[model samples]
Target: MDRHYQNLVQKLEEITHLNGVMSTLGWDQEVMMPAGASEARAKQIAALAGVIHERMTDPALGDCLNELKEKNFDHLNEVERCNIREALHSYELETKVPKRLVQELAELGSRGQGIWVIARQENKFSDFAPVLKRFLELKTEWAQRISPELKPYDANIDLFERGTTMDMITPIFECLKQELIPLIEAIQSQPLQPDTSFLQGRFALDKQEALARAISQDIGFNIAQGRIDVSVHPFCGGSHPTDVRITTRYKDSDFIESLYSVIHETGHALYEQGRPHELGDVPASESLTMGIHESQSLFWERMVAQSKPFCSHYFDTIRAAFPENLKSADVDSFYRAINTCKPDLIRVEADEVTYPLHVILRYEIEKGLFEGSMRVDDLPEIWNESMQKYLGIKPPSDTLGVLQDSHWSGGAFGYFPSYTLGAMYACQFYNTLLREQPDTKKNIASGNFAPIKVWLNEKIHRQGRLYTPQELVQRVTGEALNPDHFIGYLKTKYGEIYQLG
Candidate 1:
C-alpha cells in the first residue's frame, strides 16, 4: 500500500481504538459503574472525546485523504476506495464541528445519564430537564456545524441515519398515522380480545434471566464472545465484534419483557458479530445506520420471538422456567397473551400493533422541538397530550412519559423514527427470508435458527456500511423503503389475532 493509504489506515485504526474505549466506558457507565463515579466518568469521556476529535481533525489525516482522492485513485479496489471515501466524509464532518463542542456534548451526556437515572427513579422531570435542554442546545449547534444549510432536525437525523431527511420521513409517518389509528380502532371494536391474563403473575428474576440467556443463545448469540447483564435500560454495545455486551432489566411480573429485551439486544449483537472481519477497524466496516441496527433487534424481538411458530417451539422451555405461572396456559394462549394489542404508556412494552404510535409520537415531538415550535419545558405536558392523542393513554408522571427514553438524555435527537423504520425494514426482510426459505417458520418452530441466522448474516449483517439503507433495501427486496410493508404486516398479523377485518 502507498504511504497515503498506510497513514490513513493507521489513523483510522487509532480513531477506532479511541471510539472502542468510549464504547467500553459507555457500557460500564450503564452496566457496572458505581453511582459515585459519575463525575470521573464524565471527565474520562470528555478527555477521550477531545483526543478523538483532535485525531479525526488532524491536518495529516486531511492531507492523506486529499492525496487519496487525487487522480488515478482507482488502483485500490472498490471496498478500499469506499472506505477511504467514507473516512474522508466522516473526517470532514468531524472537522466542521469544534472539538470543544464535541467534548462538551460528551461530558454532558455522561453526567446527564447518571442524573437521568436518578431523575427517572425519583420521578422528577425538573431535575433532568435542564441537562436535557443543554444537551439539545449543544447538539443543535453541532448539527449546524455539520450542515448549516440543512434543517437542524434533518442534520441530526443524518448523524444517525445518513441520507434520510425529515421531509422523506414525515409523509411516511403521516401515512402510518392515517392508517394505523383506524386499524387499531377496528381491532378494538372486535369482541374477541387476546387473553393476556396468564402473563400477569410474578416470575422469578433469576429464572427469567436464565431463560433469557438460554433463548438468546439458542437463537445464535455467542456467549463466549458476549454476555448478558442487568441495567436500568436495556442496550447492546461493545469495543469489538468479538467482545459484545448486552444488558436487560427484569420485571418479576413480566418475564416476557426481559426475554424479549434479550432477544432484541441479541439481534444487535448478532449484527456486530456478523460484520465483515476482513475490514478490521475501518468505519465502513461498522453497521450501516441506527435504523438498520434497530431493524436487526426488532426482527428478532418481534418477527421471530413473538411469532406463533416460535412461541409453539419455545413454550416448553418457558413453561419449564416458570411452571407455576404458566402451568394452566397453553402455547396458543401464551402466544395470544404475548401478542395482545393494547395501547400502553411505555414505548418499550408496547404491543406490536401499537408500537409505531409510540415512535410516531416521539418523531413528531422532535420535529416540533427542533423546528422551534416546542420548548423543552413543555415536554411533559406535550408528551402527555401526544400520548393521549396517539395511543389513547396518558402517563401518570414524566418518568413514565417524557423521561422514559434514554435517547434524549444522550442527545440522540432524530433517533426515535428508526424504531418504526426498523419495524418496516424487519417486515420487508422477513418477507424476503420467507420467500427465499419457505421453511423459515417451520425451522423456527423446530428450534433451528441456523438457517435464519445464516440468512441474516449473509443478506444484511455481513454487508456492514457497504450500502446506504435505501440502497440495501432495494438490493435485498427489489424495492425501496415503503411503510406499506410494515403496515401490511401489522394489519395481517393483528387482524388474525384480534379477529378484525
Candidate 2:
C-alpha cells in the first residue's frame, strides 16, 4: 500500500509539473510572446494538453488509487487521504473527456486569446466571434462528456467552483440585485458626489509602475519570489509558490486603474506565495477553488485597499509619486474616490457597489449561452441591453461591452461568478479577522499589514485544498457561506460614504 501511494504521488507530481509548464507557457503567450507566434503557440499548447490528458487518465494511476482504497485507506494520514481523494476526483473526471477534445480546446483557447487582443484593440467583435463560438461549443461538449447528468452550464460551473451551480448562485445574485439597485439609484440621486477629477491626468508610466511595485511589496507581495509585468488584462499566474508572476496595465490618464489592479493581483500572488512550501506539487497544496482564489484578491482590493485606513496610511506615498495629480486630494477624498459608487463601462474598473451587477450580467449571459437561449452574434446587443437594464448605462462599443473581459476568449466559462462569490467569502473571512483582531483597521492605518497577511496565511492559505470551500468557510467563520455578511458590509461602508440614513 505504501509503495502504491508513493508511486501515485510521483505520477501526480509529474502531472503537476507539466501543468505548471502549461501555466508558464500561458503567461508567456499573454505577456511576452509576439503576435506572429500565435499559431505555433497554439500547437504547443495543444500538444501539451494531450500529454497532460494522457497522464491524468493513465491506468497505472487508477490501479494505485484502487489498491490504496482497498488495502490501506483507513491507515492513511489526513493529508495523504486528502491528496488521494482529490487525485481520484480529477482522474475520474479527466478519463471521461477525450484527449482530442482537450487538445482542441487548449489550442482554441490559445489562438482565441491572441485574436481577442487584436479584436478588442480594433473594437470589432465580428473578428473574434467565430473563435468564441467554437470555444463555447467545445466547452459545452466537454462539460457534457464529464458530467452527463448535470446541465451543461452547471458542469462548467463545477469546473471552476466545485459544488456550485446556477441554482446556488442565482438566488444570491437576485438578492444582491434586489438590494443594490435602490442603493445605486439613491447614491446617483445625491446632490453631491466626490470630485475624482484629480485622479484623471497625465502621469508617467515609470512612476506608476514604481509606485505599484512599492505598494504591492509594502502589502507583502514578495518581490524576490515574484515579478510584475504588463498585459491587456491584469492577472497573477506562475509555475509555483516561489515563482509567482503578476501583471498590470498602465493608463497615463489614470493611475488608479493600474494601482488597484496591482493591489488586486498582488492579493492573488500573496495567496500563491503563501501556500505551504513543503507540500510541493501535490493536490493538498493547491488553491481550493476559483471563488476562494478570488476571495484572496478581493479581500485586499476592496476590504483593505479601498478602506479609509489604507488611504490614510498610503496617501502621502501616492501623492509624492504623482504630486501634481494628488496635490489637492486629501485622504478622505481619496478614499471616497476609490470607493465611488457609479456605473461604468469596464467591469474591472467598476466601483464596488456596482461591480457585482457587472458580474451578474455576465453570469446571466453565460447561462443564456449554455442554455441555447443566446448566440455569439447577439452578444453585443444582449450585453448592451443588460448593462442598460442593470446599471442604467449602455456601452457604445464592443470593446467596452462584450469584449471587455478576456475570460471567454480563453475558454473561461462560468468564471465571472467567482468574483462575486469571492467578494462574499472575503467579507466573511474579513469579519472573522476583525473579530479575532480588533486592531486590523489600526494596523492598516499604520501600514502594518503583517498581521493581516499572517492571519490570512494561517487561516486560509496554508490549508490549501485540505477543506472544501464551504467547509473552509465554516471552519474559519463558524458559519456557512452567507450573503448577508456581504450585503451588510456594503450597506455599512457605502451608507457612511453616501450619507444614506
Candidate 3:
C-alpha cells in the first residue's frame, strides 16, 4: 500500500472514532440523559464538534489527500480510490465552513432538541420557535458556505441525499400526490372500512415491549449486538454496528406504534450491523446516504412488516401478548386493521398510503422557510394549512402540527424528502427481491426470514458506501429511481385492501 494513502487512512479512522463518540453522546442525550443535564450536554457536544471539525479540516489531511489524488490517483485500487474520494469530499465541505459555526450548530442542535421536547410536551410551538429560527438561520448559512453554487435549501437536501435537488424531487412528489389523493378519497368513500376498533385499546407496556423485542429478533435484529430503549421519538443510533441502539416510545393504549417503530428501527440496525466489518472507521464502510439508510428501514417497515404475510405470521404472537384486546381479532382482520388508510396528525403513526403526503408537506414548508417566504412564527398556521390541503385534515394543536418531528430541532432541514425517496427505493428493491426470490411472502409467512435478510445484506447493507445511492439502486434494481414502483406498490396493496377496483 502507498505510504501517503496509509497516512490518510489512519487520520480518517481517528476522525471516525471521534464521530462515533459524538454519536454515543447524542444517543445518551436522547435515550438516557437526565433533563437537568441539557445545558452541560450541549457544551460537551459543541466542544467535541469543534474538535471533529479541526480533524476533518486539518491541513495535513488535505496535503495527504492532494498527494493521493494528484500523484497516486491511478495506482490505488477501487476501495482506496473510494475512500480518498469520500475523504476529499468531506474535507472540502468541512474546510469551507468555519469551526465556530460547526460548534454553534452542534450546541444549538443539542439545546434545541431539549427545548423542542418541552415545547412538544406542552403543545406549544412558541417555546421552541426562537431556537428553531436560529437553527434554521445557521443551517441556511451552513448550506451556503458548503455549496455556494446551489440554493441554500438545495444544499441542505444534498447534505442528506447527495445529488438530489428540489427540481428533481418536486415531480416525484407531484406524481405521488396525483395518485394518492384520489386513492385516499376513494378509500374514504367506501361504505365498509376495516374494523380497527380493536387496535385502539389499553395494552400492557411490558407485554408490548416483550412482543416487540421478540419480533425484532425473529426478523433478524441481533439483540446481543444491539438493544432497544424508549425515547421521545424513535430512532436508530449508536457509536458502531456492534453496539447499535434503537429507541421507540410506548403508549399503553397503543402497542402498534411501539411494535412497528421497533420493526422500522430494526431495519436500520440490520444495515449498520451488516456493513463491511473489515473496513473499520472509514467513509467507504459507512452507509451511503440518509436516503439509502431510510430505504433499509422503510423496506422492512412497509415492504415486510406491513405486508399480509408478515401480519399472518406475527398476528398470533401479537394477539397472545394482548389477548384481552385482540381476543376476537383474527389474522385477516389484524392485517386490514394495521393497513387501514387514513389521514393522521403524527407522521410516525401514519398509514402507508398517507405517509408520503406528510413528508411532502414538510418538504414544502422547509423549502418555503429556506426560500424566505415563510417565517418560524408562521409555522403553525402553515403547517395546519398544508395538512388540510394534503390530507384533508387539520392538526388541532401545534404539538400534533408543526412540532411533531425532531428533525428541525436538530437542524435536519432537508431530511423530510428522504423518507419518501426511501419509500420509492424500498419498493423498487422489494420488487427486485420478490422477482428474484419468488417465494419471499411464503417464507415470511412461515417465519423464515433468513433468505430475505441474507439477500438485503448482500445486495444493500454489505456494499456500504462503495456505490452512490443512485448507483446502488441501479445495480440492485436494474433501473433509475422510478416513483412509479412506490405508487404501484401503494395502489396494488391498498386496492386489494380497500376493494378499490
TM-scores, all candidates, are 0.98, 0.99, 0.99
lDDT of 2 by residue, 1-501 (tens): 489889988999999999999999999998999889999999999999999999999998999899887875678887899999999899999999999898998988998998899999999999999998898889889988999999999999998999999999999999999999999999999888988998988999999999999999999998899999999999999999999999999989989999999999999999999998687689999988999999999999999999999999999999999898988999999999888999999999998889999999999999999999999899999999999999999999999999999999988999999999999999999999999999999999999999999999999999989999999999999999999999899999989998988
RMSD of 1: 1.0
Between the candidate structures 2 and 3, which one is better when assessed by lDDT? Answer: 2
For candidate 2, what is the lDDT? Answer: 0.93
Q: What is the lDDT of candidate 3?
A: 0.92
Per-model C-alpha lDDT, please? 0.89, 0.93, 0.92
lDDT of 3 by residue, 1-501 (tens): 889989999999999889999999999999889899999999999999999999999999999998888884676777888899999999999999998899999999999999999999999898999998898889888988999899999999999999999999998888889999999999999999999999988999999899999989998999899989999999999988898999999999899999999999999999999998688688888888888999999999989999889999988888888888899899999999999998999999999899999999999999999989998899899999989988999998998999999998899988999998888899999999999999999999999999999999999998888898989999999999998888888888888998987
Pairs of residues at least 3 apart in sequence or in different chains that clash in candidate 3: none
User: Model 2 misses residue 275 by how many Å?
Assistant: 0.7
* lDDT preference between candidates 1 and 2, better one: 2
Report the Cα RMSD per candidate: 1.0, 0.9, 0.9
Instruction: Give me candidate 1's TM-score against the actual structure.
Output: 0.98
Which stretches of model 3 miss by more than 4 angstroms?
none
Candidate 1 collision pairs: none
